[model samples]
Structures are given as C-alpha cells and as structure tokens.
Target: MFTKVMVANRGEIAIRVFRTLREMGIRSVAVYSDTDRDALFVAHADEAYSLGPGLAAETYLDVGKLIAIAREAGVEAVHPGYGFLAENAGFARALAEAGIVWIGPPPDAIDAMGSKVRSRALMDAAGVPIVPGVTEPVADVDAAREVAERIGYPVAVKASSGGGGKGFRVALTPEALPDAFEGAIREGERFFADGTVYLERYLPEPRHVEIQIVADDHGACVWLGERDCSVQRRHQKLVEETPSPVVSDDLRRRMGEASVRAATAVGYRSAGTIEYLVSGEEFFFLEMNTRIQVEHTVTEMVTGLDLVREQIRIAAGEPLSVAQDEVRPRGHAFECRINAEDAEQRFLPSPALITAYREPAGPGVRVDSGVRAGSQIPEIYDPMVAKLVVWDVDRESARRRMLRALDEYVIEGPATLIPFHRWLLRQEEFIAGGALHAELNRMADAPTPLPPADGAAPAQAAPGDEAPEPAPQAERHFTAEVNGRRFAVALRYDPPAGGGGAGAPVPAPKKRAKRSAGGAAGAGGATNEVVTPMQGTVLRTLVEVGQQVEAGAVICIVEAMKMENEVAAHQGGTVKELRVADGQGVAVGEVLAIVE
Candidate 1:
C-alpha cells in the first residue's frame, strides 16, 4: 500500500477518503482553498496545503497548482474524489507524467467516456443498449432541430461533455427548440467549457438505476448490485437505496453482467458506476461515472465492502478480493443527502453559518459529515453538507430507519432537506416503488414548516410573562455570524465605579452592524429593492438601466453553489439603477437593482 495519498477534493467526500486512508495505515494529505481553510476536511487530513483563494478554476480545479502541491508533499497517489477534476483526463495524464500515482482509472478510459457523443457510439459497438439519439454532435440549433424532427417530439438537447444534470435541456415541441438549444449550449460552455451538444429522445418517465462495478489490474472484475436513484429533484439525486424495491433477481443479474462488460470494454480499473435509464423491462445506458460515486455509501452498507479501501488497493496493484459470484448483497440500505437548501423554494441553495449541528446515532445509522456546529456552508461549492445512511433487514424497514435518523438529525441554520426527505419517504407513490420526481415542481410551491432557529425556542412568552432581570456583575454571552463565517463572543459585566447594586442594568454596547428581524437592513419587498435571497455571484444582469419591466420579471441570474437562480423583479417599473454587473459577488439581501 502507498505510504501517503493526497485527496484532491473537499467537503464530505474528502473526509470520506481520509478515513479510509487512515484505516489502511496510509497518511492523507489535503489541498484546500482559502474559503475552505476552516472546513472540516482540512482539519481531518494528516497534512494540508493552501491553494490560495478564488473560484474553482483558480483553486480546486487548478491542475498545475495541485500537481505542484502533491509533489511538494511527496505523496505517492492522488485520489480525486467525485467532483472538481475527477473526470479530467488531462489532469490524470499530467499526474502520471509527473511520476505520481493517480488512484483512478486510466486517462484513456476517462477520455473514452468523457464525451456523451463518443460514449454512445462506444456503448453501441460494445453491445450495451444505448438510447436512440444522434451519435454525432449536433452542429447548431438547426442541426438539433433536424435531429429532433427525425427522433420525433420531446427530444433532449444534452451537452456532449456533461453529467450531474448540468447541461441538459428538454424541448417538448419545435417552438421550444431554440431556447432549449441555446440554454444547453450556454450551460455547457460555462460548466464544461464545451459547447458541443447532441440530441436524444427524452423518456418522460423512467426509473434511474446504476450498477456498481470495480476492476483490478490483474484482470479481475466484479459487480456489486445496483442502486435505485429514482428519488430526485432537478435531475439531481436526493435519496438513494440499494436492493431496489422494483428490480427483480433476474434483472439484477443481467444489469450486473452488463456492467462488468461495460467496465471491461474500457479496460477500466478501480471503482466506477454504469448509470442506466430503466423503463419497465428495458434499460439503456445513460453514462459512466469514471470515479467513485456520491452514493457509494449505500453500496458499502449492503455489500459489506470498503469501496475506497478496494480502490486504494487496486491502485496499488492489488488483485480483487472477492469473485463475481461472491458479490451478493444483503438486506437493504438507503442514503439521504442532507443539503443546506430550501426545498419549498424550488430547492434554492441557502449557504449560511451552521449555528448548531448534531448527527444521529444508532445501530445502523451512519453520518458522513464535514461540518461542525460552527461550520460555514459557503456558497462556492455544492450545497451538500453531509450524507445520512441507514441499513435494515428490508426496504420498508430501511425506509423507517432513515426516517428515524432524519428526525434525529439536528442541523439548525439554513433550511435543509430533512423535512422534505421526511415528507417524501411517506408519499404514496414513493411507498409503491414509483419514481416520484415528476411531482417536485408542484411540491416546490407547497407551504412548509421553517427550520428551527439555532436550537432555541421562540422568544415570545405568555401574555403576562416577562424575562427576569440580569444580576449585577454577572457575565453573559452573545454570538453572531457574518458572511457565512462563524463567531463566538462573550459579553462580560463589571459594575461601573461604586454604587452598583443587584438587578442593575448593564449599559448596552454600541451597535456594530445594522440588522433586522427578517434579515439584512434593505431586503426585497413589494415595491423596489431587488434583493438576492442568498449570497452568490451575478452570472448575468438581464435588465439594463432605464429598461421597463413587469412584476416578477427575471432581472438577473445569480450563481450560488454551482447552481443558477433567477432573481426576479419585485414589482413592475423602469430599471432606474442597475447596482450589479456580471461576475460581481453579492451578499444575502444585497440589492442587485433599483426600480421605480
């Protein structure tokens, strides 16, 4: 085994890798940006280095800087956990040329599966069923339209080099093609730096399932069952479970065998997943994640395998530990992604200070978290704070265990998906093994209970109830958070001069910053102030100064936590003063435009 390994990522996944490295008696190194300097993963690593402060392009995704740091740390292998440059073939090649071990599949395998257009052709040639779509990149909007016409209505214009629901757009009719094509291209260029896109026949309703497969350098490969990731929102999985309530034994065997074939076709090694779109009895290839998946925990729960340890061992030239027939999964497992987001508000990202935090504890409940009570959930990365996983004897029992774990989870600051998961697990459609994501749009508009306030009850007392006066010379404490950073403050009392007595009031300190019961000083309203609900960077300002607009018109788009949110006008009027420009950073309740 390698003596030292560097985790080239952050958040919960980084911590997940560190734990496995420690178990294998290997030292773990961490690279972090200034925003993540105080993050939990940084503190967990045996060694840490700084990547300065900037966007992902300048920090986590900076290949050159990362390689330099790894060389400086004298690490043997690098583990690109899930995001950032996990699938970047160039990065993998760069690391290999620098003589450092890359704990992932080969660069050629990554390249083969990096582009959807290329992968579709490869899958077709390898006898893996692929969706009916154009194998070549659609030239332009007209080209996409032509392909759509051939494929019939309800075509999907997806970015050739995209995954994780980033560069996907669906058009139900010819009239929607222009906007869909343009949006997909823009997001593709923005995220992947690839403007190429392809057309596919969109499936209205299909269950999302993916098979977990691991390969070794010694020509050994095994499939570890399948995970049903049908519970989703905006095409991103919110909940995942293994031993799918809907998958039959024969179907599992077929998918598992096909997964092994997919991995073998690419000469793949280490851990990778083959995602499929299953419609009743048939399943088509969706994409191949050439790295460890976010839901790998659920697979580990039921299979009794340490996937990261296996990945590390495989990268170290170790052979497979278990054979294909010995890869039988048992019981049931579920993973709920606990994110700092408001589910009722269209699942908007809410980056804020986690004033209080607690993980549920039980026999089978496991929490992989990267935040503490004073942790700051910044708006620069994914909004996932942690993952809550549970296992039981069966699917229904696992669902109930997940519910109990969720109820016991205490994350008090920004609104989270705990309540939403609680609601979803009990839905009739969900209980019947149906993919209930089609109802998310309608559920987003429903009224919901707000998250708890710093684990403190409401300050309002009974009609005649009153607060007891503070005793003189007693010390007190007050705390606050500014710009998603935590702080702890102590306010002590010392009686002034001589005539101090019991119940004497202490002079209040001068106010430092202006705040309100609702939020910041100048928040959005029915009239003017077009304010942002969260802190983020302005991706675009649609309305120029002096432009006339109507109420609820989208004035600009803000990018927070890698997700785009449209900031709409509070009321109808002329855009008197545009306060923000594209690429400018703004804070919560910060004004973006002034209208009259």
Candidate 2:
C-alpha cells in the first residue's frame, strides 16, 4: 500500500479521503488555493500545500502544478475525489509519466467512457441498452434540427464530455433548437474545453437511477445495488437513496448484469457508475461516470463497505475481497445534499460565512461535512456545505430517521434546503414512493416555509425580517498582499440584538410574490424589473431591447456555482430597456432588464 497520498480536490471529499487514509495508517496530503487557505479540509491533512490563487483553472484544475506538488510532497499516489480532474484521462497519463500512481481507472478506461458520443457507440456495440439517438457528433444547428426531426421533438442536446448536470440543454420545439444547440456547445467548450455535442431522446419524466460497480485488476467486478437520484433540480441531484423504491429484484438484476457488461466492454477498473434513465419497465443508458460519485455514501451505508478504501486497494493491484454472491445489502439509506442554497429563491446559491455549525448524532446517522463555525462557503466552488445521511431497516423508517436528523443538523448564516427536505419527506408523492418530477417542480416554484417565531430552531433561513440583508450588521473585505503574495481578508462583526452595529445579520429576502415596483427581489413581481436571483455571469440574453414577450418568458440565462438559472419576466410586455449584455457579471437582485 502507498505510504502517502495526495487528494487533488477540496471541501468535504478531501476530508472524506483523509479520514480513510488515516484509518489505513496512510499519510494524506491536501492541496488548496488562496480562497481555501483556511478551509477545514486543509487543516485535516497531514501535509498541506498551496496551489496558488485564482480561478479553479489556475489552481485545482492545473495538472502540471498538481503533479509538481505531489512530487515535492513525495507522495506515492494521488486520489481525485470526484470533480476537477477525476475523470481527466490526460491527467492520468501525466501521472503515469511522472511515476505516481493514479488511484482511479486506467487512462484507457477513462478515455473509453469520457465522451458521451463514443460511450453510446461502445455500449451499443457491447449489446448493452442505450437511448435511441445519434452516436456521432452533430455538425451544426442545421444538423441538430435534422436529428430532432428524425427523433421527434423534445430531444436533448448534450455536451460530448458533460456530467453531473453541467452541459445539457433541452428543446421541446423546433423553434428552440438553435438556442439549445448553441447553449450545449458553449457550455461544453467552457467547462470541458470541448465544443462537441450530440443529440439523444429526452425522457421528460424518467427516474434517474444508476448502478455502482467496482472492479480490480484480477477480473473481479460486482455491482453494489442501485441508487435512485430522481430528486433533482435542473438535472443536479439533490437527494439519493439506495435500494430504489421503483427498481424491483428482477430489474435490479438486469441493470446490474448490464452494468458489468458495460464495465467489461471498456476494460474498466477501480470504481465507476453507470447512470440510467428509467421509465415504467424500460431503462436507457445515460453516460458513465468514470470516478467516485458524490452519492457513493448512500451505497456505503447499505452495503457496509468503504468505497474509497476499495479504490485504494484496487489501485494497489489487490484482488477483490468479496465475490458477487457474497455481496449482501441490508437496511435502506438516504443522502440529502445540504447545499448553501435557498429553496425559496429558485435554489439560488447563498455563499456566506457559517456563523454556527452543528451535526446530528445517534445510531445510523452520519454527517460528512467540510465546514464549521467561521467556514466560508466560497462562491468559486460548488455550493454544497455537507451531506446528511441516515440508514434504517426500511425506506419508511429511513425517511423518518432522516427527518429527525435534518432537524438536528444546524447551519447558520446562509439559506439552505432543510425546510424543503422536511416538507418533501411528508408529502404523499415522496412517501408513497415513485418519481417526484411534478412534486419537485411544485416545491421549486413555491415559497419554502419559515420557522415559527416562538424561538424554535430554524430548519432553513436565519431569524431575520423579509428584506435583502442591508449592507450588513457590517462585513467588510480587504485584500492584503505580503511579500508578493495576495490574501483575501474579511472582517465581520454582528452585535447583540439592539447593538444596531455595522454587522447585524441582514434580513432574508421577501417571497417572490410580494416584490413591488422599485424594490430588489429574486424576480419581477408587482413590477416590470426583471431581476437576477444570484451573483453570476450572464451566459446569454434571449430577448432584445424592444422585443415583445409574454408573461413568464425567459429573458436571460445566468451561470452561477456551475449551474444555469433562467431569469424570466414576471409579467412580460415589451423589453423597453436592456441593462445587461452577454458575458457580463451580475449581482443578486440586480435588474437585468425592464419590461413595460
């Protein structure tokens, strides 16, 4: 086994891998940027190094810098805990050249499953089921139109190398094909540095089910049951559970068998997942993730296995410890991703300092988190603060247990999904068990309930009035450069209730429905000011200055925290003035346009 390992990612996954390394008596290294200098994961590492300061591209995604750090730290292997360079085939090759073990599938396996287009063709050749669509990249918008007509409308335009809900667009009509085609290509190029795109039949309301399979070098591979990730928003998974409520014994067996075949076809090794879209009795292929998944925790809770350890063992050339028949799963597990987002505000990213932090404890409850009091939820990375997971004898029991745990998980200083999760758990749609597309939409469009004013613990928002946090009780930031290096310093002081100092906590924004003329809100409501819900870059503007539009028409697209949010007109008429343009940075509640 390797004596020391470096984790090339940050936040909870970094700390997660460090815990496993510590248990195995292996030293773990952590890499960070200026923004993450004081992050909890950095403090948890046995040896830590700085990756310099800038966007993710300059820090976490810089393969050359990462390899140099590994060499300096004298680590034997590097483990990418999902995202960043986890599935990067070129990085794997570079690591091999540098004589460092890449604790993941071989470069060949990654390359085989890297491109969505190629994987579709490979799966079809392997006789595994696949969605009916083109295997090759479409040439242009005109070409995409042809495929849409052939496959019928409501087709999906996806990035050739997209995953985790990054580069996907849907066109429900022929008139929307051009924008969808262009958006897919643009996001593909921006995120993955590849502008290639392809089309697939969009299953409008299919359950997002995936099978987890691990393999060793000795030709031993087995599936670890299934995880239903149907609870999602904008294609990003929010809730995941093992032993899918919809998948039956016979269906699970078939999906498992098919997953093994898919792995074998690519000569895959290490940990990987085969994601599928299920409708009624039919399941279609939806790309493969050639790395450890964020939801791997749910699988671990059910099967009593440590997937990270398995990845290390496989990387060390060890054979499988348990055979296929030896795999026995017990209990039901559910994982709720506690992201720094406001469910009432269209799931907008709400990055801020966590003023207070606490976790639930008891039997079968675990909180895998990377933040604590004073931890900064940086906007430069993913908005997820932690994952709250629970296990029980059955799905119903697990659901109730999760509710209790969610109530116990305490987070302050940002809006979160706690209230929405509590609400959804009690809903008939979730309790009865099935796909939750319509129910999720309802929650997404409606306002999340506020905590009762009787001094009870808050499940979601902080205790404040209904308005944008005024300039603060006062939190101010400054940049300090010492000896040629820069540092970001933020000093905040929130006084006791009546101090009325500069840093008092700001009131939560009001519900979207109550926005009157001239006031800042998430959306345009009793007024014509089309406002953005969060701070991000304007990816596109759909309408012109004088373009006539209908109520609820999409006016622009904003990219924040790696997710695309559409800014729509509350009561559209004519776009009298356009205040923003494409590729511009926007602030929260900033008006994008004025429709009169």
Candidate 3:
C-alpha cells in the first residue's frame, strides 16, 4: 500500500476517500479552495493545502497547481474523485509523467470512452449492443437534421464529450432540431470544452440501469450487479437502488457479462460504471463513466465491498482480492441524493448557510455528507450537499427504511429536496416499481407543500378567543471585524411562551441603501433591464449596444456549475447598455443588459 496519497477533489467524495485511506494506514492529503477553508472535509484530512480562490478554474481545475501540491505533499499517488479531472485523459497522463500513480483507469481507456460518438463506435466493434444513431459528431444544424432524419423522429442531440445530463437535448420533431442542435453544441463547448455533438434515438420511457465493474491490471475483473436509477428529473438521477426491480437473475447475468466484456474491450481497470438504457427485455449502451460513480454506495451496501480501497489497491499493482465466482450481492439498497435546491421552484439552486444539521442513524442507514451547521453552501460548485443511503432485506423493506431515515434527516437553512423525496416515496407509481419520469415532472409542476414545523402544538382556545402570547427571545452575541473596524452583532430567536408584554428594545445598526441589479431607471425613468437568473460567468455576449432584438432573443450565455444557460430578452427592445462583458462573474439578479 502507498504511504500517502492526495485527493484532487472536494466535498463528501474527498472525505469519503480520506476515510478509506485512513483505514488502510495511508495518510491522506486534501486541497481546498478559499470557500472551503472551514469545510468538514478540510478538517478531516491528515494534512490540508490551500488551492487559492473559490472559482473552480483558479483552484480545483488547475492541473498545474494540483501537481505542484502533490509534489510538495510528497504523496505517492493522486485520486481524482469522480469529478473535475477524474476522467480527464490529460490529467491522468500528466500524473503518470510526473512519476505518480493515477488511481483510475489508464489514459487510453479514458480517452477511448470519453467521447460518446467514439465510444459508440468502439462498443459496436466490440459487439456490444448500442443505440441506433450516427457514430460521428454532426457539424451544424443541416448535418444534425440529416442525421436526425435517418435516425427517425424524436432524436436526441447529445454532447459527444458530456455526461451527467448536462449537454443533452431532445428534438421530438423536425421543427425543434435547429434549437436542439444549437443548444447541445453550446452546452458541449461550455461544459466539456468540446463543441462536438451526435444524434441518437431517444427512448421516451426507458429504465436507466448501470453495471458496476471493478478490474485489476492483472486482467481479473468482476461485475457487482446493476442499479436502477430510473427515478429522475431533467435527465439526472434523483434516486438509485440496486438489484433493479425489473432485472431478473438471468438478465442480471447477461448484463453483468456484457459489462465485463465492454470493460475488457476498452482495456479498462479500476472502478467504473457502464450505463445502459433498458426498454423491456432489450438493452442498449448509454455511455461509460471511467471513474467511480456517485451511486456506487448502493452497490457497496449490497455487495459489502470497499470500492475505494479496491481502487487504491489496484493502482498499487495488486491483484483482485476475489474471483468472479465469489462475487455475490445480498439484499437491497437505495441512495437518495440530497441537494440544496427548492423542489417547488423548478429545482433552482439555494445557496445559504446551514443553520441546523443532523444525519440519520441506526440499522442500515448511512449518510455521506459534506456540510455542517455553520457551513456555507457556495454558489461556485454543485449543489449536492450529501447522499442518503439505506439498505434492508429487500427492495420494499429498503424503501420503507429510506422513508423513515429521510424523516429523521434534519436540515434547516436553505430549501432542499427532502419534501420532494418524501412525496415521491408515497406515490403509488413509484411504490409499484414504475419509472417515474413523467410522474416526477408532474409533481414538480405542482406546488410542494411546506413541511410542518419541527415541533408545534395545537390551539388551546376557540376561534373567538384572543391569540396566544409570543414567546420570550434568546439573544446570542458575536464579534467580527469589517474593513479594520470591530463590531458586535446579536441575534434573537423567539420561542413559544404565555406572555403578551413587549420585549426590551435593542439599538439598531446603521443601514446602507442598496441598488437593485437592474441599475438606475432607464430612459423616461422606465427601466427595462435584463438580469441573470443565476450566479455564473458570462461566457459570451450575443448582442452589442443599440442592437435591436425581438422577444426571446438570446442576448448572452452564462456558465454556471459547468452548465451553460442562455439569457434571453423578455420583450422586443434595443440594447441600450451592456453592463457585462465576456468572462465577467455575475450574481443572481445582476443586470446583464438594458433594453428600451
């Protein structure tokens, strides 16, 4: 085993890798950006290094900075945990060139499966079942339309180098092809830095299943089984369970064997997942994730395997600890991704300080979290705060246990998807083992009722009686420095009581008037400003000052959390002023342009 290793990632995944390394008697080194200075993961590591600012490009995604940190930390290997540069062939090759072990598949394997178009071609050559589509990127709208016509209607325009549902769009008819093609290309270029896109047949309602495959450089490989991630929204998985409700023993064998064959074809090693789209008895290849998956917990819960440990051992030139025949999966497991977003608000990101936090425990419940009570959820990264995983004797029991655990999991700062998960668990369709894509969308469209207060009492008087008295307040004080000046701040929380008297008055601090992002009133004191819907970077501006545009015209593109969103005009207008330019950082509601 290696003496020391550095984790080139952050959040729960970083802490997860640290735990396994500590158990294996290996010292773990962690790197963090400015926003994560006080994060739980930074505190959990044996040693930590500062990676500069919170912006990903300046810190987490800086390959040279990471390499220098690894060298300074004197680590033998680096683990690129599932995101950032996890599957980057260049990063893997660079690590190898620096005489450091890369705890993932070889660069060749990553490159082979990195591009969907290229991977489709490779899979077809290896005799793996693949979706019907062109195995090459379509250059423009005309080419995309030509390919879509051949593939038939309801085709998918997907980024050739994208995954996690970021650069994917569907064109259900010929009229939607132009927009779909343009959107996919923009997303591809923004997220993966590759403008290549391809067309494939889109299955309206297919179960999303994936096989967990672990391989050693010594040629020994085994499939852990399959996970059903059909419960999704916007093409991203929300819930995942192992021993798919629909897959049978015979089918599992076939899929597992095919997954092994696929891995072998790519010359793959270490932990990876081969995703598939299953419709009835027929299954087609989706794509291959050349690193550990977020849903790997469900497989570990059922198979009783330490996948991270296996990855480390494999990278150390170790052989497989168990043979194919010995691999067995027991019982059922489920993982719910708890993200900081409002389900009722179209799943918009909610970044706020976590005022209260608690994790469920007992029996088979496991929570892999990255935040605490005082942790600030930064807008610079993914909104996933933790993953709630549960296991039981079977699928039904696991489902029930998950519900109980979710009720006990407390989070009290930003709005979260807990209520949505609760509602989903009670749905008849989900309980009956149905892929609830359309159902989830319908539920999201409806208003989600707020969860009841943690603890409350019923009224003790009749409707005509006076209202109950307010509770006494608790005051907490803190000291802080701002701009070389020290100030004391006090917070008061009111609890229920039986008193009606007014409370003591506290001196109020001086307040400063703030201007809205729309800026001062425009011409005729009637402002028509275009604002950013979310916090992100301005990738490019589509219009110049005084440019006339119609309603819904694209004015600019903003990149946030690795996804690009086009900012459009709400009404026909001329661009009076462009307050933002390319490469500018913007906050939610910040004005991008003025229209008049």
Top-lDDT structure, candidate number: 2
> What shift in Å separates residue 451 of candidate 3 from its native position after superposition?
11
Candidate 1 lDDT, 420-492, residue by residue in tens: 6776787777778876765763433321222222222213323323322122232234579999988876454
- Arranged by lDDT with the best first, the candidates are 2, 1, 3
lDDT of 2 by residue, 1-596 (tens): 99999999999999999999999999999999999999999999999999999989999999999999999999999999999999999999999999999999999989889999999999999888898899999999999999999998799999999887777999999999998998889889889999999998888889999999999999999999999999998788989999999998999999999999999999999999999999877888898899999999999999999999999999999987778998999999999998887664567777777776778999999989999888988777888989999999999999999988977776667666775577667766788886568655644553343222222333443433243321223334569999999998756555333222121132233343532222123353567788886788898888998899876677888877877777777665799999999999887678898988
TM-score-wise, the better of 2 and 3 is: 2
TM-score pick, better of 1 and 2: 2
lDDT of 1: 0.82
TM-score of each: 0.86, 0.87, 0.83
lDDT of all predictions: 0.82, 0.83, 0.81
Q: Candidate 2: minimum summed lDDT over ten consecutive residues — where?
A: 498-507
Per TM-score, the best of the predicted structures is 2
The residue pairs that clash in candidate 3, if any, are none
* Better model by TM-score: candidate 1 vs candidate 3: 1
